[model samples]
Target chain A: MDITSPAFKSNVKRALADKQLQRAMGNVKVGFVKKRSAARDKLPEFDQLRDQARDIKDHTLEYLDLYYEIYEQKVREAGGKVHWAATAEDARDIILKICQAHDAKTVTKGKSMIAEEIALNEHLEAAGITPVETDLGEYIIQLRNEPPSHIIGPAIHLNRDQVEASFRRAHDHLPDERSLDEVSELVDEARQVLRQKYIDADVGITGANYLVAETGTSIIVTNEGNGDLTQSLPKVHIVCTSLEKLVPTLEDVSTILRVLARSATGQEFSTYTTLSTGARREGDPDGPEEYHVVILDNGRSDMLGTEFQDMLRCIRCGACMNHCPVYHSVGGHAYGWVYPGPMGSVLTPTLIGVDKAGHLPNASTFCGRCEAVCPMHIPLPKMMRHWREREFEHHLTPRTVRTSLGIWAFLARRPALYHLASSVFIRALKLLAFGRSRLKSVPLAGGWTRHRDLPMPEGRTFQEMWRAGGHE
Target chain B: MSSIDKSKIDTTASRTRILNKLGATLATGKDRDARAEAVKTHLRQHKRNLVPERGNVEGAERIALFRAQAEAVAASVVEVKSADEVPEAITAHLREHNLPARVKHGDDPGLTGLPWGKTPTLERDSGPANGDDAVSLSRAFSAVAETGTLILVSGADNPTTLNFLPENHIVVLDAKDLGGAYEDAWDRVREAYGAGTMPRTVNMISGPSRTADVEQTIQLGAHGPRSLHIIIVNGE
Candidate 1:
């Protein structure tokens, strides 16, 4: 919950040295990219569905007010309640009150980024209620008291031995010498430990992948059934989600679902895609007795009607980060927020002020793989550029960057001076290179040359070469 | 408990403030009534978007595609001539897995009418699962042939718990209930439960519960059923 984005550079440096994290992040490339490509090849309409999904989100946001009203009415009609929060504190207070009303002692939670945004677990603990994370990845991070590194895979930065260590520390009742070397053993341990917590929990909280206005249902897609168990067995279920997750109809949500799983995990569909409308119906055998939805607008409302509004269209697929070279190299904690990867780079600066998270937008190389693989077709690189421009205007950039950019801007305004300066600079670099075609290092460019050699210029600038080659 | 003043709830204030912010930000001149009308029109149309050619076949071709896709996801399926054969299928499946012949189910009419008496050795109990139940059976409301997804709505007759709380989950469906896409299954839901209203829960189970969280290696039975078995009763 603390803002560490300002230290993104140092975070990245530490992440690069973390051997376990680098090894874990390597799995992202071979796992997600190849599976997604295969899934996309199988479905001929994957690209078309991406366009349709984008339009669906855009249309819903344009008239978000109307959709909210409809969704609220339908929710209430189905014997459910809807709560709106203007900030993270407002949401936390509403949930705490609901838990208090139910006299809840233990609250079980599914993996929700919004919950992390509001810091719900800490709030509930401070109020003397035990909050247990039910998802395997979430449970691991909760035990370690760490923020999630990946949106979907919270424990993606840790190795198996690390998880075994965490389990031994947390579950002292279990025998110390129990075999926990295999992944299956670790999974079984968590499953057994969390099963009773689900039944004992008085309230359950989950995030919605999509909120259908037609049926007022909150949908979640997950491979593990922990979310379903958390919501079903508990006496009360609370959905913590943002306002932008709304869609017009079930058909619209269906269209998006076709692409969501393919892009996220390359599965045709997740093992469990449940649509919960409200509380348990009359004569229902078993389910939550009461249902409530808490919608938060923590700086998201301002994103509407701006160039950054397209960022709101993101479905939180994590595909952008899966395909992101920077994310794979540095890992997610470097982004320093609840969301990580390309989506976090653009969104963190908007939610938490750009002054605090200015380094996130600059971290990208703008290779555009995030935009290329985005199911919603969000222009992530363009939005990051917007953040950079805002930082420049606000004078939040460091003095060195500002001075360099200022000097470049000055020369660009005069084409003749820029050409002359460039040619002279190239000749000097050639002279420094001796007979070699590469410069081992250059003044004020140690950062680049430390990792790889800088190619030397061929004694002439591009302008001279173009003229010599008769291209002009 | 005494009732609190409805107007003083903080959510009401937050709700009003948020809608105001949304109005100011978007600046859409259309009044509330016009926007509501547009939403209503869209809901009324409920038009299906592009349907993939993968599952666009009809009749036996559609059924073949569904079986192929479902099996592709590690879900095993069996076809029988009528409901009379369902018990035998379940018995055979259990025998193969070395699991118990005892199973739990809800009071759904489709499941209740089955000739389960034919398998005298198998024991069937009716109700929701209580964590120890090895296997649970439920009649699917319908299924989407597009992705081999089973559609089950919650009610007293077909409890939602039976779908998740068992190690092995068995779903029986009529061949006529299988449709080409999720849109078709949704139409069936509306016809059964009316528009704008849904059951408490609708589960679209594709395959058995699984997780790839550990090293991105998928392992089945992550706090839910490890195996999902489907029995389709074909029409003569």
Candidate 2:
């Protein structure tokens, strides 16, 4: 919720030095990458389904307004209410009002990024209503009073010991010497602690993976059934989501569903893919008494026809972040916002201003792993480049960097000068290498050389070698 | 204005503004009727898109694939010859797992009509599951063999609570009701509950609830069923 994107450099420094964070980040590198690749290999139509998923979202966005109208009508017909919010503040207020109207003292929550985007927990706390996060990762971060580092795994930046500490601190009533060194033990402890919260809560809130207009259904694909219990046990259920989550039909969502879990956690299907429509029907033995969906615009409507429009096709799979090299090194908190990794780099700048989040887009190494793995096929690197261009156009880039880029551009426009300068630069770098293949440090490139040694260029440039008949 | 009315007006205005923004981008001087028709047709036609070939097996192969896939996800699957043997199979499973013989189920006639009395020692009750329920049983509306998912619809017959509240969930899925893909399951739902209508909840559960949140090391039975046992009845 804090605008730490402007201080991304400082965040990076701390994250790189954090021993716990680095250790925790190893899980992202080793776990998600292998699982996703293996899952992709098993399904023969994985790529074809991805293409279909992209087309479905593209078609939905193209006719978003009509879909919204139809979706709203269906929700009303099912006796569920739909509320619209044009801004984050509006969304927070709408949810708070719903909670207050129910006279809610406590509200249980399933992991909803829109709730984080709107900063709903803080708003509810200010209103004297306790919001309990039911998702295991979300609940862990809530104890630490931290914003989610990763979208799917909010507490992926935490290790087992850190979770044990959070639990010990929060569940003070539990035995002081209980065995919690095991992951299963820690999971069992949270299950016992949150079970009461699910029942005591007056209302439940969740995020929608896809909102079906055909049946007015909000679907959630979760490995853990926290989302199910969160909505089912409570008297009232609220769905906090954005406009892009809408799909035209159940069949369309099924096509997207085929790719969502595989791209996210590499499962053919998540353990629980629950499709809920309206409130509990008449004679239904157990379910929420009321159903409400809060659709937050939050500047997303502004991205409709823009280059960033492709981003709306995202299913929040977290594959881009999972495969990102920059994310692997620095971890998620370094980005300093709700979302992290490749999707966050492009999205954070749009939600928050580029002036504040300019460093995010620049954080990418342009390795193109994100685009290659993205289930929605979002051109993440291209979008990040667009943000950089916008930052330059608006003069948001630092003056020194701008000046250096200006000089590079000037030289790039003139082929003869570019060749001569590169040749001289290459020879100077070769002399500095002292006949070695690398340089420990370089003048005016301290930042690049600080982390690792820079490889020395050859004595000649490509132009010189080509002219000297080295092409063969 | 009153606070309630003011909030109401704000939401109304926000809805109009959001739709207007979308219109400005998508329908600016374009054929509005064409756009609306395109959306309507897409929703109405509800065409299946790109069903994976992995789930296209038939008959015994489909049932076998479902069992294998479910087992792969840590769910225990047992096949019996008839619905009459479900009680004995469930009792054996409970005894083997060292769980209590008591189980709770919904009022699904298919389940109630079964010879639950065969295992009179197995204490059984009907209605939604309370937090104390250790094992809850519900009949699956259908199953997807492609990914080993069981589809359960919510109603008085099968309350949604039984799916999540219990520590161990035992579901009775008829082999005749199992399908090859998620699309097939959706087709069954459409036939049962007409087009553009759905039960309050349609749960497609592939395995017991699990969480990988703690350092990405997945632990089973996080906030939902720790163990899911499904009994597939092969004979009518």
Candidate 3:
């Protein structure tokens, strides 16, 4: 499940070979991208709102340390526990201790990207405690013993038959008579299995969609109400999130929610908008008895006051992923991290060492779809290019790419040599092709012709054609 | 007052320094409550009952419409012309759904007074429904015309589990019980609870339990009430 391992690449390559995954990913492009556009177009106010949302996050990230305190105080006032974790290890260890204290044998989890960032489930399993992923998407991947391929659609690489097969191997209680061909049957089976876990689980772990400093509320937006059951049924509830997830006030949380739903799923709002205060208050019949909030820094605190600070404004809508051409082709797992798509390309380098994730930044076409549809208006391509520039400056760029760039730079600097070389090159390439329409494979340039036809020089170079016209 | 509080950490001194740094950058000359204005405007649109109803339907038709919508959401449906007929309606629906027709702590005075002892009764105060063979009749606080939402207030009599944790949900609502707005419904709940005793849960459910979790496929009653039945008695 670790991104640094070779397993990550192999998993992606295997997914690439999966025709179903390719189709599902292609479907994502039309589904989310088109729907978000239509949703955004319907609300002209969306742009104005995006600007405000970004500013709110920018303001919050700048004063993150302050907001964290204010939020902590409010939670304490409501008799809740708050823990600050500077790294994923710290966060996981803290949660593990809490579980141990409660003598918890089974843990039920709601979908939280921070948990993925920290690899929480692995740590829990290492401790010999069972952690059941309750989100439908998260459940599928967890059952299949694979990491989430995409952020929003965790099992986007899986189809119905694959899921049925996975279930046949996993769920022991699944009756033979239950129709396994249709998707609904598969869903019902998973639900029945998960329902048992919910009842047995003593602790519930979830992620906050937005943490309101004003009310000290960690808000979760879910369609399935699984999060509600996770946090409610268990005696203990834990919220794990990044430092940047905080908002200044309740009003700000609402503003983000407006854009969060629209950009993420084209919905006005997610169905279960649970605003959980501390834990269950005195005489409260339904909520958890104890609530704990864990905020993990995970190198995000350093991101503040930097040019790339805008990246933190992201609501994790996956819009950038939906529109990204590189992501559309390669999908999320190829990015090799918990975060995938454009944001991952920018962040993976920053967090996991630019040297390790150097291939991620270079994978972009710089088409700017990620930037254009961003709900927070993050300049993604600019950030990616900045990372590329950083990589080149840091000598992280490979010898081959650098040598080619150096040759192009040298040629462009000397125009007379460029024209002389270019004209000679065109004539030589044309003669070599025998005036054919395309070059099947040429020396160093053969890589270009692997799947594409490199066109032969039609007439002359642009310099020659312009010179022939004599300055029109 | 505006939102839920998840946690409250204390780093007052660090917070002050960070805010000072932030103020030096952005809060130059004007109040930045202008930013807070965005959330204020959006909270306005999330209003559900703002949608105007087509035409007012009272009496059994209103009850029938509620029943039909509830039943469509995996809830059962029953129609009774009078409160006296409620027992028969309740008995038939439960028999069909295979749930025991019983009063699990009677919160609805109208349904309980309908001579339930004459027809058949399994138990009283079945405690929690526990997704077993149990169904409890409760009165809807108010119904929203636009979304057909039924507001349920949980007290000692009406356990919150009946509202949730049930495979099938049956609600008894009067037609004239339709409230004005979500705000109006909230006001009614606050009034019913009095100053000192607000119920543990006040649920405003328009439709049955729903989820789009399975590859974004819509499924009703993922957790709460696979079936919702509204027995309308001339909206009495």
lDDT of every predicted structure (CA atoms) = 0.90, 0.92, 0.69
The predicted structure with the larger lDDT, 1 or 2, is: 2
lDDT measured at residue A25 in model 2 versus the true structure, 0 to 100: 94
Q: Write the residue-wise lDDT of candidate 1 on A87-106 in tens digits.
A: 99999988888888887899
- Candidate 1: list runs displaced more than 4 Å: A470-472, B1-9, B31-34
Candidate 1 lDDT at A378 equals 95
Q: Which candidate wins on DockQ?
A: 2
- DockQ preference between candidates 1 and 3, better one: 1
iRMSD (Å) of candidate 3?
Answer: 7.0
TM-score of each: 0.98, 0.97, 0.79
Two-chain complex of model 3, DockQ on C-alpha atoms against the true structure: 0.13
Clashing pairs in 2: none
Candidate 3 positional error at B90, Å: 8.0
Candidate 3: deviation at residue B2, Å? 30
Q: Across all candidates, what is each one's fraction of true contacts kept?
A: 0.70, 0.89, 0.06
Question: In model 1, how large is the Cα lDDT of residue B172?
Answer: 92
DockQ, prediction 1: 0.65
Better of 1 and 3 by TM-score: 1
Q: Residue-wise lDDT of candidate 3 within B1-236, one digit each (tens)?
A: 11112222333443354445545554456456754454334333322222223224555555555555444434444556677776677677878867765555444465456676657664556343454534555777676442355776554455555665556667886666665334445456446744212343345565556655445556775655566677765635
Candidate 1: interface RMSD in Å?
A: 2.1
- State the fnat of candidate 2 relative to the true structure: 0.89
